[model samples]
Target: MRLKISLKGAVQGVGFRPFVFRLATELGLKGWVINDSSGVEIEVEGEEKALQKFLLRLNAEKPPLAHIYSQDVEYLMDVGYATFEIRESRGEGRKEVLVLPDIATCEECLRELFDPKDRRYLYPFINCTNCGPRFTIIEKLPYDRPHTTMKTFEMCPICKEEYKNPANRRFHAQPNACPVCGPWVSLYTSEGILKADRDKALKLVAKALKDGLIVAVKGIGGFHLMCDATNEEAVRLLRERKRRSEKPFAVMFRDLEQVSVYAEPTELERALLLSPERPIVLVRKRRDLASSVAPGLKRIGAFLPYSPLHHIILRSVDFPVVATSGNLSDEPIVKDNAEAIQKLSSFAHMILLHNRDIKRRCDDSVVKVIGGVPVPIRRSRGYAPMPAKLPFKLSRKVLALGGMLKNTFAIGFEDTVIISQHIGDVENLETLRSFEEMVFDLMELYEFEPELVVCDLHPRYETTRWGEVFAQSRGIPLIKLQHHYTHILSCMAERGLKERVLGVAWDGTGYGEDGTLWGGEFMVCDYRGYDRVFYIKPFRLIGGERAVKEPRRVALSLLFEMYGKSASDLNNETVRSFTQDELKNLYIAWSKGINSPYSSSVGRLFDAVASLIGIRQKLSYEGQGAMILEDLYDPLVKDHYAFALEDKHIDWRPMFYELLEDREKEKVPSRFINTLAKMCLEVVLRIGVEKVCLSGGVMQNDPLVSKIREFLEKENFKVYTHQKVPPNDGGLSLGQAVYASL
Candidate 1:
């Protein structure tokens, strides 16, 4: 008997084919396994018993990274195969496997590393078929060694033998390496003496942590600012040095036990911690480890090591360690040694260095529980470059230059949209250059050449600048996509929506085509286009950019608008912070139209309400006030807040005014958040669009999203949200690419 098997999903580059070949051979069966553009395929011609055994094992034991959605088998009469063989990559069919992100050292590799008799004992870079680098090391597709960063390191004799042997655990492991012939570790202070002794170097790092010293450690993807998680003094110092105030810090623990002490982990949470991606997951806090870890927040973001270096460090410490991105407030994580030394000089007391060159810079991915599912916060490292299946393939190749903040570009052709790793806001020169470089690298790897380019309608965005420059150089057509449209389209593309749905884009700000600030918008649209169906009433931001950080200013501005013209009286306490001269300039700028533009963003509304309720007064970070306010919403309350439907638009003035009344009446914070959530739901459903897609940076507010979801489900409406790409502008380019194609 002869049978052909098709394996789907994340079965590629994970040793799936090699495992199948070994299993078939062990079963005394003759078969061939090959990879294609879609997934893995196998053909077997052998005894019935052997074939049955192979099938049983194949279903039961797939690779750790391979997730088979379905496996189809077809039987054919005796088309004899003499022996088992592994065939070459066949790109003829849609059988592409899901390529996984790099994983930390596995149990088998760890055992080998610690074994006194093993050749790879104490090898810091030890890896095998079951674990090691994947996304971070690869320079191109097909995921072979020649296309990876490991190509520079010629395999030692033992490793070469293991790689060639089909029966070996290291068979065809592209990143297979040992300490003897792999990347080496080093430690250096600001004065610059490279310490080659790994044990001594790690000890120095640990000692620094113990002494309340901040150290910048070069991680698998990029640099991480490390400190003792338990020490409040050290945490406070880190917060001050990094200029991160009040925002929760993500902690890395040795194991799940350490995580359990800080937060409650469900079965899904446990699986996420152990998953190869090993992303930072936000969970409900069990108790405060220290006041500084996540000051004023009810939840904590925690993760486990996804690299061998990380494992060793965690093992050495035997406790949770704070491992946040090693960059100042808005910048991207530093990737180069010289850059790290220069940029982190002020932030770190010492640097645990290494000679291994990092060709790619990736940040740790973040996720949070929303309705019992992992929602991607910042998609990078473990989850980037890996294409999201578009609802429909593109008609022409296109490049999408995303918005200004949390910038990430996308290149799409045929069925795949390769979103670049998180390239921070392209506002500054260095960030713009980084964006260009990251784009060039990804394009080279994918061999992507664009016939057209898409950019934000905003003329001031650095992304738009690059798009214009590149378009002029290439003489390609450039399409200017509206910001909110992209937000809606991104959700549609992610959920594989075939038709138009209600798109709600509520955020801080976006440059509207009509030369005004946009953020609060309701649109009826698809990938091709959208019509602004509804919006909040426009209001002036008292001091322009100053209003974004200071919620009090936003609250005062909204109150002025809501309470009619006289509410702008300078003597009012709401507007008391600004000086007379400053107030005069702001009023003139807003009233006579100098620098201010009217905005109707829901995010601004949240900021205003949060400030009015005294939930958050001074903004220490971007979205800090809103994030903390969101963290305060208690789901135990079951009351509905009121919002009225008028002229096909859901009016928000009523809710804000009501909240102001409640505040005057001294209502609880939980009641305020619950009421606001109720109002948002009423507004969403009032539009009469049952299929609602919620997105925007502000949607990352878990409390708001969770409550809205609950209300929508109760109303028997299907609510669509961002499960793949982030709801923020980091996810904008993918949506832009999708819309541009349409």
Candidate 2:
């Protein structure tokens, strides 16, 4: 009997072809395995029993990194062949093949790195079929060496032998190389003058890191500015030079044990840290470290070394080290050696350069455990370029340009949607350039020409403007989606849901259909369109965008709403912090409605409460006040303050008054948060929807989400939140793509 089989999904660049070759040869089968534009293809000519056994073991004994999304098999005519072989890849077909995300250095490759007897020992570019750069190195398709940056490096006889031998682990590895023939590493000062090369360069880079200097080390995806996490001066210097204030930096530990010493990782978080993706996991801080590392945050973003070079550096250092993206604020990560030297010289003391070129700029992914599941906060690196399977197919290609903050874009064709790796805010010129490059790169890789372009409804967003330009240039139609509606749709798309859902979206700000800002929203939505059913009580933003940076302005606005301009004279901490002149000006602005925009934003409410409770008067980043509010939560406080629902509006003024009265007696951030959760539950019940979807950046708050989910589920409602994608604007593009498909 003869059979032909087709396997799709993450089968390319994961040793799938080699695994099939070995399996067929061991079973005494005459067959061939090859990769095509769609996926992996295998043909076997053997006995019926052997074919059955092969089929069973195919999935059971496949490579660890291979993920089978679908498979098809059919009987074929028996054409006798001598032995099984791995054939060259076929490039002509619909380009539906899954591109593997960059993988961390496997245990076998790590052993080879440190083994003195190994030929590739201490080679920075060492990788095998099972691990190392995949998406970041490949410029085009078929997942072959010729299509990657590795095309420049000619493999030596020893490496060529390993590539052709199916019995070898490096068989058909696109990046297979050795110290004699592969890409080499070099060390240089920030000024681009070479200091050392190869093994000596690696040693010197490690020594520089140990001596408390910021070293810009090139890694799998992009360059990382690294320094000892325990060195206060080094951490402070990097922060100063990078212009990053208050936002926590992700620290790389030597291993899981060292991570546990600083952050209390749950079992799931530990697994996430050790997974092949090796994303930075947010966990509760367990011990004190450099004060400048995370500042006042209660949690730290931590991860283990993902590459051999990272492992070597971390192993050399006794303490954790800050491994942050090597770009300045609001810019894309540095990918090219020349660009790194030119742009990052002011921030980095030395440069660790490599010859392996980075084709894509992917930042490290970030996740946090919520309700015992790891939820993506920033989905990139190890989880990008992989398409999300849509429930329905698209008639034509669609392009989705995400929102202004925490931006990510997507391209959709047929039943697959490939969302780009997290692109930071596109407001900056450099980031916008990176965004345009990514759009062109993805189109080239997937052979896609979009028929329609989609964007947020906000006309002022840089991404929105870019989408309009792209659509006009292509002579295609442009679709605009309301920001909160897209947030809910993103969650719905991940779940493949088509029915109407009661979606509660709570974020900092989004452009609403009514020409105002909407954040706290209740909507009845399906794929085609949505009906805004309810929203938070409208409040005046005292200083427009200035209120976002200063939470005290929001507090004053809320106070003026309840007590008039005389409210500014109240003896509250937030009120007293302002000068009498500043207070008078703010009160006049709120009372006269000058420079004040009305908003129904739950995020501003959190910021207001945070300021009224003396938690944070100013915010350095979006959602900083909310995050601090969550951290200050006390689970034991079960009582909630008062709130009211009038006509379709959820009024929080009563709650604010209660908080002001209880400020001295029962003052706690937890009580305020619990009240908000209960208020959401009340709205959910009033909406009377069995299927509820909670989304938006505020939903990233673990305790708040857990509380809302717990309350809703207890009432027999099916609660849906984000897991595969972020609840924040990072996941907005997926929603736009799916909405356009509908």
How good is model 2 by TM-score? 0.98
Q: Tens digits of per-residue lDDT for model 2 on 338-377?
A: 9998998999989998989999999999999876668999
* Candidate 1 Cα errors over 4 Å, as ranges: 1-12, 27-61, 67-82, 87-99, 113-122, 564-573, 579-585, 640-642, 663-686, 740-742
The number of the candidate with the highest lDDT is: 2
lDDT of 1 by residue, 53-74 (tens): 8888887897876767558999
Compared with the true structure, all predictions reach lDDT values of 0.78, 0.89
Which stretches of model 2 miss by more than 4 angstroms? 664-667, 740-742
